[model samples]
Target: MVTKWVLLPVPAQDADSIELDIAERQRKRGEPTSPSAGELSDDELASEMLRRTTFGAFIPWPESALERLAAATTETTRRWSIVMTLCAESPGTLFSTTDISERTELTIGEWRTACRHITPHLRKHYKDAPLWGPGLYEGSTEWPLVTMSGRQLKLRHELHVGITEEQAKRWRAVLNRTTQNVA
Candidate 1:
């Protein structure tokens, strides 16, 4: 087989033209071509940045949700620790019992105890829906906002979206306040 080579003039694209083409494609796909920060407040800009960091994988929870959870679990040390540890992780992170134990320096038994304590709160928050439902994880019913597969663990979708460094710090502050109150 003989391959024929034909030389043709290539069109040159300037920087601005290339950029316009990209913007046009993005507009067609219904994406914002640029940030309109002038119209957004400081808090709104921060929230928008957080949302972009998720890349559409998950939606971050509102301040009220985090406040509610922190308040709900204040009296439980282990549960509060676990919640803060998990919230410190990136959204959609998958870990394990060993992982949580290592992070919290708490025993597996304590982790189990914490899960038992938190499950009721979670069930109420989720309107009594069975979590880690069929085919996801069959480990235990006591884990709310978390699912286990064999030995691996992950935050349930609703809770996972709320994990962020800032959120984790907020949880830590809550834990500290409770500890101070008790002491």
Candidate 2:
């Protein structure tokens, strides 16, 4: 039997709430599937609300890569949402040292050092590493997410990060949502 999974970045702090939401989706809100979202377990529903009355944690990276990025420093995990969001929106745009902090919401000088070593490695884990990792562009023509100069932010790659088929699907969903929202 094949199992399906969704790879959303439900932080440990938000997991319980998300589980509650999933249950809510399965039960109370699946009305299109039934009168009470009924008969079928709450999970048997066909319709669910896109905007649940709850908040979801913003997770920029998933487990495998997030750990490595976090380990790069105590900070990458914290700053990635803003950083990745900017890069996803404008790939290959050179943000100077000053620009990164102001535009990307990164604290001043935060990305100055650890970024070079950390950003490039994301390519090892993600083809489109920006969604789930640092959006780094070092202007190497031979590689993806590359630019004409090795400065600024960008993200592009194909998935090669030893993930389950289910995880890949989740990644696809993540990429799609990121693109859709940015567009």
Candidate 3:
């Protein structure tokens, strides 16, 4: 089974409150919130939800989503390490290959090669129904202007393309869970 660790920005102690706050805000705005505020706390809870509730199988790391992701694949190890480092430097914006290379000492060519190596795996595990067009990769734009949504969408399109219906459903569940956690 593929496993991935994601470094959720929400701290364990703050997760519950954040969820509540989001729910309250949604209610006030009359907008729907994906996974109600009472849904999760910490990476363990998120992983439990992903396993017991979604994929019906246990993933290896739950202490921190990033830890699980780190253990999932050697290729992902490099990609996520770079991603986390980029996130640390820039909180909400996307980072291009040049930005990552310049910031992390991975050359632009090296970054592209690493991304290409991991693209198939990311597509296989994380892609859901194409909400948008085909997903975007590092070399799509000028270099440093790709957004998170673009990368994720591209991965999802690659994964779901020609997949069995049942597999798609399961994949969608995983995607939804991820969306919830990120939100």
Candidate 4:
């Protein structure tokens, strides 16, 4: 498993209801409506969300990695929908590109085009450890956050091993519904 993971800026509220629940609790307590609004950094908020929802409190995933996963779930982009679909479907399991394409009901060409859009972003945002080599110009057919080997794609090992079965089902429900909005 690769130890280096991409980091994203902010935590996404869509991945779980914890933030909303917290906000409600605050309301009951007559506290501010925004939970931890300025108190926690983007990385901290992301870590808190993942700890409370997807992974248990003990998973050692770095804050940035957590933010990355949160961002993946929250994005409305076609490329992100592809990633969310793959992760939601397989989690830690390996699935082929063909499998993901069939699941998305996208032709291989469309799938490839979606993947192409992710490369520049990944290359720009994660230059320190380039997620899928340096660039698409190098003939990389891999995704930004997803781990790829030939045609086999899997969620990052941390996500695969860290996310529980029940949590995965929640993620599947959220991701599957969001994926439908891509078209």
Best by TM-score: 1
- Give residue 79's lDDT in candidate 2 (0 to 100): 56
Give the runs in model 3 whose Cα sits over 4 Å from its true position: 1-65, 125-183
What's the CA error at residue 131 for candidate 1, in Å? 8.7
Local accuracy of candidate 2 as per-residue lDDT tens digits, 78-177: 4543454444454323334455566765665565443544455545544533342233423321122222222111212211111223333444456566
lDDT of 1 by residue, 1-183 (tens): 222222222356575776687679767877766445554455444534444444232223344454555555454543654555564655434345556666666676676666556656555563333334344443323232333343121222212213444545555666577678879
lDDT scores of the candidates, listed in order? 0.47, 0.38, 0.42, 0.44
Greater TM-score among 3 and 4 belongs to 4
Q: By lDDT, rank the candidates, best first.
A: 1, 4, 3, 2
Q: What is the lDDT of candidate 3?
A: 0.42
State which candidate has the highest lDDT: 1
The regions of model 4 sitting more than 4 angstroms off are 1-76, 124-144, 151-183
Compared with the true structure, the alpha-carbon lDDT of candidate 4 equals: 0.44
Give the Å shift of residue 172 in candidate 2.
Answer: 9.1
Q: After superposition, how far is residue 142 of candidate 1 from its true place, in Å?
A: 12
Which segments of model 2 are wrong by more than 4 Å? 1-74, 116-183
Error of 4 at 34 (Å): 56
Model 2 lDDT, residue 154, Cα: 23
